[model samples]
Target: MAEQQRLLGGRYLLKEKVGTGGMATVFRAQDQVLNRAVAVKIMLPQYAGDPTFAARFKQEAQAAAALQSPYIVGVYDWGKDGDTYYIVMELLHGTDLKSGVRSHGALDPKKVAQIGSQICGALSIAHKHEIIHRDIKPQNIMVQPDGNIKVMDFGIARAKNSHLTQDNNVLGTAHYVSPEQTRGQELGPTSDIYSLGVVMYECATGRVPFDGDDAISVALKQVNELPVPPSQINANVDGDLERIILKCMEKDPANRFQTADELRQVLNSYLAGRAVDVPEPTRVIAGMAGAGGTEAMRMGDKTQTMVRPTAPGDTASNPVIRPNNQINTSSYDNEKHGMGKGKIAAIAIAIVAFVAIAIFAVSGFLNGGDQKSVPNLLGMGQEAAVASIKSSGFEPGNVNQSYNDQYSEGQVCEQTPDGGKTAAAGSKIDIVISKGPKPIDQVEVPDLSNASDLDEAKKIIENAGLTVGSTTQEANDADEGKIVDQSPKAGEKVDKGSKVDIVVSSGPETDSVPGVVGKTESDATNTLSNAGFSVNVESGGTSDTYAKGYVMKQSPTGTAKKGSTVTIYISEGKDTSSDEVDVDSLGLTGMTAEDAEEAIANAGLKYDPRQQSSSSVEVGNVIKYSPGGKQPAGTVIILYISTGPSE
Candidate 1:
């Protein structure tokens, strides 16, 4: 994952891989320009070469970036860097609901309701824009530390008005896929509700409602089987929650919650301990059924809505069996029961001759025919692509519009019967044109009054798609550095990237207390008083190292309100040493050496005696003491006695 550390889009510096999914790997990256951490989902290398994958990747960005909700992961930016496609999003610091459920068994009833409500809120926003999150499961829901939920991964989401052709492969996990999705039919908001029901089922029961040995078996179960009531698996599950789950999982979309807002209202009623309005399920059977007309039933819900194909006796939902190009002749053979053996042989020989003639005609057509490969028209202008298709002996079919961020407006982003595929002359090829980047909604300013500091306010503004503008200082009594007021007041809607100016509290009209720790007491007092602060002096006691009468310390050194008191501590000079002796009046001329030693010791001084020849005093007697006055307690005193006139 060395590529994870590379700078993408010239701004996002990926740090490491956070997760890997089927189509992309998510990396925790740093937005160097904004100086914030974000999650960057990078498309896998295998999908880089695929134009369809590229289109889907861009579609994800367009769908998610247009939606603004607290419960949805915010998409900041998206673009292509060289061969890699990446989407930058808000970095979440919690585990997904699937992991949370696995680590800790079933969740509490109230908590499940709350989480479901938040998810509903997010889905409500997407649904309002006609976007349907085709895949909704616990794996795509993040449970934050503060108990908030964030729904993620709108990669497969498509708008209700989107004209993109549906693919044969299912887009969601089998256990959570709705009946329509399992049958590869058109999807709507109800499909997401169905998947959400599966999520709640797992949350309440600590297990998925449907599981099997293989994906196909699980998918088949999703299409045909009924789920067990959550209360049966976990007796603690209340009837209200169970009803909500069952209603959402109803076989018929009409029987389920019609809109996300309706589901949210139901969840809110449950949370508020009020009676919920649950609709009675109707019995509607689909093409697939149990033996002998047995009804697929579940506790407290007894309805089935069977989605039928175009014709009767069509079991197209059976994943194991598929319709083949070769026509079946069994029905025709069954009608010939009464025919004679010779007649049957003659008929078989005629069929063989007819097949041979058809093969011969096809061979001649292939040997010399007007056929050509469909040229790649993607990235070309719509008019140009249509011209190219016609010039290549092919007819241009219907043109559809889809939102794509990578391709410019009116450019051909996708074409059916893709490039290089062999098509017969004059065949119609459909194309999808780009509508350019999706429109993003205006951002509302978040309340910044609770911001603890400037940095926090800046972060809040930036996260809301606004920038921190010029800051003004105000005097607020409560918090010194908190935000006092903001321009374009909180809750006011402004264009994305608009500047929001803020006023910060400097705390009661304050000024920075001047620094005067080493100045004399008078000088410090003068400086403090001049800066609009009242000055007070305190004796901080003597210091052996500091000179007398200098300011040694101060209180409120950084800042204080005007006229607030500033306390300066003045030094009282060096402390006296208790062992020092004052010997200015001591007499040593008549004292003998022993007496002098005793006197010095009594006075806290060291004595050293020297003998000298002298007529005025006897030998070995103290005649003089040198350099002894106000010395430390360990001062040494030298006593000299005269030694009889000797040089």
Candidate 2:
């Protein structure tokens, strides 16, 4: 049967293979139960049988499913059918970031920052959950049609508390792995930030920061080499963006942005046209193998022996035999020599002594006849130290460089054999050169003014290579729970791992608004105003319980912010339903139009004068009026006036 027709877990019907990776193959499939299309990732048969890989695969599904964000691909389901293990995820329609970058060269600096900000948002959520995305290469980022990105493939992400031995070997793509990851060191959110830095670098330069013929070579570079500034590769890259990217790629985790959110803030600030405060990128001292060379080997907790490949006509590949140390006298027969056993023993001893003396004389001649004291090369420059060793009758063996706090760079920090110690002439003396004191990692204090809450401020402070010193709450105009102040303020240069103190706002001061339901309007206003609240008065129509001009209702009857407005309603007295108007008082029959209007105005009723042709009454006179009965004040009164006789 064709692969597309095959069904897994009796629910996911495989359609077509969409992509393939080192550990699994992704297929666009239909989810029968949900009746929707999804991307199903099936573990390759080779890895599916391995218990460790299987467990990690399951973990990927669980971890990705737990994270819900627009920038993160959603995981729906995962299961095993027979020997096949598959995971179903939201199907996306966009090319991977790697493919896009390859098709189109380096992107605009602003575009790169925007993409980075989105990715950081996704990482911020994951890091908060204690999960580190071991792999963060362009291949795992999908650039959607709308220009937003969704991070995919949490296959190698390891939770902080995970016991899986999956990290026995480096897990991420070598070109983008962090230095600590290359050395198999413990990883945290910073490790992921390092990888993100590489991604942004690649996005800005159209190439990876490090590359070689093989993964090991690339991995070694990640640990030892400093990346060439992105601006060099792409001059369009601005200084601010380049520094942000390089900061992410710092060799030391302490030197890199401590948290994804911290990096995200910087990127967002750049995008928002705000000034960014990123320091210059760190430069790591070249390792023993020097920069950009594969000769250096990195060994982590596990011991590794690197064997050089044999070259043509290499003598080291061949084995050699050495003669036994003991003198052999099997060829000499005492009986044939016609000597007694005692005599033969003396002869043998004499021969052995003569040979020993001859050997000693030859060794003495080869070693310049005598022993000499090794020179005191300590504190001497490397070149001077080597020269001194030669002049002092000693040969310089191996010269190695190490970080020494007590010595300056290029000075000899230590030497084998003390200056007074005697060694045979021509013996090799080893020396260690100083590379200077290890550079103290420095980190900039992050601006905490934008922090929304104390917890967020703490994360920002800790992520910026500082510790939260203490937190105090103060009443202020700033919103409650917001960070209002900080110590050793942002933009200060401090040693990495320093402490920072912060202050949190408890919101504005407030006072109780006194109840004014039964008080007069003037008294109610005074009561509210004296309590530090501004008063606003409104009419409360006809309240029988409260007398006229008295407060009937009030808003915010309890505690309220000081200087805030308080609304009070004044009663308009009891209802006048019992009052009525007499019908005869209006008097409109046979009256003039002007006279009728005056009568309506006197009674507090509105006048509505209408014209009609009247033959029985005088012209321009009021002929009749309708509905002459009790009416409320402001009610319209309609009167028919004579418009002379109708034509």
Candidate 2 error regions (>4 Å): 284-647
Instruction: lDDT for model 1, please.
Output: 0.80
TM-score of 2: 0.46
Cα lDDT of candidate 2 equals 0.82
Each model's TM-score, in the order given? 0.47, 0.46
Could you tell me which residue pairs clash in candidate 2? none
What is the C-alpha lDDT profile of model 2 across 1-647, one tens digit per residue? 77689898989999999989988999999989879999999999999999999999998988888987768999999999989889999999989999999999899998898799889989998998888998999999999886879999999997777887446478899999998888988888998999999999999999998999999999987877667778768878877898899889888788889988899878866764558999866543444322342222223332122222222333222223323321112232335655756567779999999998787667666767587767888789989998999999889999899998777899988888877566888899999999988876878889998988888899998778777754545678899998888766789887776667677888877778899889989998888888888889999899779999999899987777789999999999999855555445767888888988898878777778898998898987888876587877777777888888778
Candidate 1 segments whose C-alpha is farther than 4 A from its true place: 280-647
Q: Provide the overall lDDT of each model, using Cα atoms, as 2-decimal numbers.
A: 0.80, 0.82
lDDT of 1 at 479: 73
Report the lDDT tens digits of candidate 1 across residue range 1-647: 47866999889998978899989999999999989999999999999889998888888898899997768999999999999999999999889999999999999987787788888989999999998898899999998886778899998887766655365358899989998888988888899999999998898889998899998898877766667667767877876787799889887888889899999878866664457767533333465443112223222233332221122212222213323322222122334667766567779999999998787567657856766779999789999999999999999999999987667789887899999776788999999999987775788889998888989999999999887654545567757788988877899887787767677886776778999988999899898888888888999898876678998889987867778899998999888766567776567667878888888888878877777778777777777887766788778888886665665
